[model samples]
Target: MTADPKSSPLFSFGVPALFVWLWSTGFIGAKYGLPYAEPFTLLLIRMLLTLVLLGVLARLLKARWPGWRGAGHLAVTGLLVHGCYLGGVYYAIQGGMPSGIISLIVGLQPLVTSAVAIMVLNEKVSVRQWLGLVLGLVGVCLVLLEKFGLNDTSGGFPAWTLIWAALSLGGISLGTVYQKRRGTGADLVSGTIIQYMAAASFFAVGAFAFETREVEWALPLVLSMAWLVFGVSIGAILLLMWLIRRGAASQVASLFYLVPPVTALEAFILFDERLGLLAMAGGCLSIAGVAMVVMRPPPVNKQ
Candidate 1:
């Protein structure tokens, strides 16, 4: 008996599913992480610690470092995925937009990534993917519309929230495209460690330059910071790298569409947020669309 290549390793898809779930929970992670430390300071420390942890892990595993040539390539990844995108989103969440809203909005990353892939990566997408993109957009729109209540006073969120959300999506799409064009330089552990450190550096620099308000001290805050470090940065990233390494980029990114709904579900379950009609519908639509687009197997290699 022989293994079927058509299976494409269930773990590849499985890992991304878990990755999105954890990512959905990242809102909770950020919400908890921010109270104790400034955003920049928090991100900075998270990256630094991740780098150290990865370094030790690599050393034990006898990891190979790609050295300086790899560093430049890694820097770009850090900037888009970690620095601009994450930095913008975290600060926005800290600034006040709800995590659910942000996830719903950021869910557009796959659609954007698809467009970019067509234009830049020269990757061919099926009509199904385009349909999926539209359906996903509608779902996102439903989620956004729910944010409004009939009340007239303060009836809307800060305009900047949209800007920040867009920035986050834009960064991620650009980052994905960049990765497709330029494969990573260092090994997963090393790549992540370096990428995170770069992001952390940006945050640290920002904290020193801009943060002014006093931060509260407490156990929850300490725990939150630790969670961001070990849980989100370390845990989630490794899972992400695993998925990317094992699966096609389209297949891997499609999993991100699941993040919003799953995160919303978690928020409702754990945080007592409402599971509204819009959220439910949007979740379904987004999932369906993503599946259609991602599940379409890439053109079979010609013999």
Candidate 2:
């Protein structure tokens, strides 16, 4: 008998929603987590804790590890996606690039991923998806222009911040394509442990070399660390891995397009940041682009 499709309906759609929610909350978690520990140091701790918890969870579920075969690929994936991408983002935020602007910058990831996929994955993207990508790019520019005035509060997007943001976006885009290029079917839990461990190594070196990271052990700091370990490292990363395994990488990444608006909402409530209607308009554009791209039919096989 023909086996059930890999992406059964119940799990497939729900995965994206979970990915969005886990990722959305992570922005706030980062805001809380990074202030206490240095950026690279915090990431190392998160990655370290992520692997530990993933191992336990995997053992509980008896999830089979992919063994050494997938190790190198997972290592490279983690270095690019988590290590470089998050390292840059955290560095930028540490320099006072507002989370909204950070969102706008990193939020363009879906469009960038599409471009990389075209070259790397040889994925067929329809003209409609192309238009959606264009819209997303325009939306990102609008959000940046409207909110992050040319001269930001913190030294007007230092040269390093701009370059780091670009590299971060590139890392994420390349990671998306790489994941597709490598193909997915390995056990998600086992795969994530490898990825986190890889990221942990990169960040550990960064932490030891560059950062003072002499953080005092306070109750709030310790609590924030726990939240980040659970919320972002374990929750967001695992959901992302599962989604990539189950569906189109680009389609899975569309949910990340929601991160900008969700982050804005959280910023407003938590940080007392203002997001005017114009900013919200840009958010709507991003949401529209995501809808257009993800719902489009897959490319047909040529006769």
Candidate 3:
């Protein structure tokens, strides 16, 4: 019988690569969409649209729904992974924290996830993996170093905004470990539907409570919404859940190290952003770091 292509090495590597690329575009999408809508309002619309699309998909695919207990677990994951992480990021940026600073703050996810995983999941991290995590963080710092012109302060950096960024970091790091610990074995499609429902409700509340809920609905906003809803919320998120189910939490979190570098490249291409040599070097280090964390050693031959 022919080997299942899903088990191929290419599939393993390709899926993560695709997830990184798609996730990076989220920054680009937010940049395009945020101009036309408040952050909470924009996320509210995106989550609702994602729910509608996923609902239809679940119906067509006859996806299995988790039990109520499983659904509650998924809801918690959603609140942390989608609600806190995305909401915090948007609020921080809206509150005038530079994107580079926010990225660096949130880019600490791998280290945080690894640390939490050790305690929560009792997952073992080799020294090599620890080194990789540290290197990845250093790489992210280098990539974003030029953008750290905190001296300017013309954008009015509120000290409180750092709290939002820190919330984002904590949410994603804890969320990954939580998912690895409690989110396994659920149906990806239906479980993710539950997740989106919870996240949508969170954003909806934020929109009503805080945002004006005014959306300009221009072409750029529309395109950004479409991409974020279909490409990121659906595509990349599903891949993330799949990876979490199949890999260690720390291993999966390492993939996030690539996001800032990839986002920088996307911004450079789409928004005419400058890429310094340090950023290029940092990108290389991030790639190497992730490879170390994710790559497993070959089996030794037994005599």
Candidate 4:
């Protein structure tokens, strides 16, 4: 059987790098947009715009809409992946959790996903894969340590907010497995449209109930929202779903280990954030760990 076009070689080498680059910009986008609007408010706008833009693209491409069952599955996955996960992170950050601390906490998603995949998806994980997960985690922690050290967080962050961050990690972890298990064969463009619509509803409720819904309407905020809507939300997510469909859930989750380091680099270039030698070493370790998981040995056939 041939691989789906979405799962072809283009994804093998190029997609991961492009996805990482696009995904990393999400941090930058949040940084730019958050000052102008409340967390849920900002997310609501981004989700709405993402829906509109993707809807247009889906029509232009004449994308096939999933049946009701697939649409429901995708919507639920969207709630977890986009709504709960992003809501937690944004809320935690808005409530004063440092971005570095949040990133470190969320970086644990691979291990969580691996554990869940083992139990729920009945996936067999090798010792090498476990080692890669741990190594990647350690690498991320080291990079965060250099950037944050013990002093990364100040005193005022609420315990509940940290819990929210953890919830975000869980959301994404479970969402990946759910996507793989239930959403493997869905149409990308239309499925994503349903997802954003569902996610937008989630955030819209929060924005209306909890937020004052004020937006500064600054050029920076507008630009950030545009990038997030078209670039990260659409581009990065399509790549993510493609990866999940193409590889093991654990391996797909491992890719997230690259995010913090990549984001660190982006911050360095864009915002002049520090990227010390220790951070570089940690980044290398992260890469090596991802390789171990992603580049598994081919199956040996016994005649």
Best by TM-score: 3
- Stronger candidate by lDDT (1 vs 4): 4
Cα displacement (angstroms), candidate 2, residue 162, comes to 2.1
- Candidates' lDDT values, in order? 0.72, 0.75, 0.90, 0.89
Stretches of candidate 2 exceeding 4 Å from the true structure: 1-13, 150-155, 297-303
> Can you give the TM-score per candidate against the true fold?
0.87, 0.88, 0.96, 0.94
Per-model tally of clashing residue pairs: 1, 0, 0, 0
Error of 4 at 156 (Å): 4.7
The C-alpha local distance difference test score for the whole of candidate 4 amounts to: 0.89
| Worst lDDT 10-window in candidate 3 | 146-155
- Cα TM-score of candidate 1: 0.87
- For residue 250, what is the lDDT in candidate 4? 92
RMSD of each: 3.2, 3.3, 1.7, 2.2
Q: Which candidate, 1 or 4, has the higher TM-score?
A: 4
Q: Could you tell me how far off, in angstroms, the CA of residue 298 lies in candidate 2 after the best superposition?
A: 10
lDDT of candidate 1 over 6-109, digit per residue (tens): 46657545656767877766777778778777777777766777778888898898876667868767778777888888877887777777665676667777
Sort every candidate by lDDT, greatest first: 3, 4, 2, 1
Clashing pairs in 3: none
What TM-score does candidate 2 reach?
Answer: 0.88
Clashing pairs in 4: none
* lDDT tens digits, residue span 1-303, model 3: 899897799998999999999998887888788889998899988998899899999999999988899999999999999999999998888887888778888999999899999998989999999999989888888888854553455356889998899889998999888888888889899989888888889999989998899989899999989999999999999999999999999999999999999988887887788888888999999999999999997899999
Model 2, span 1-303: residue lDDT tens = 775665565565566666676778767777776767889988887777777888899999999777576778887888888888999898888877776677777877887887777777777888887787777666656655666663445455566777778878888878877766663756777877877788888888989999997776677667777877887778877777767766666776667777766666677787787877777887789778777877756699999
Count of backbone collisions within predicted model 3: 0
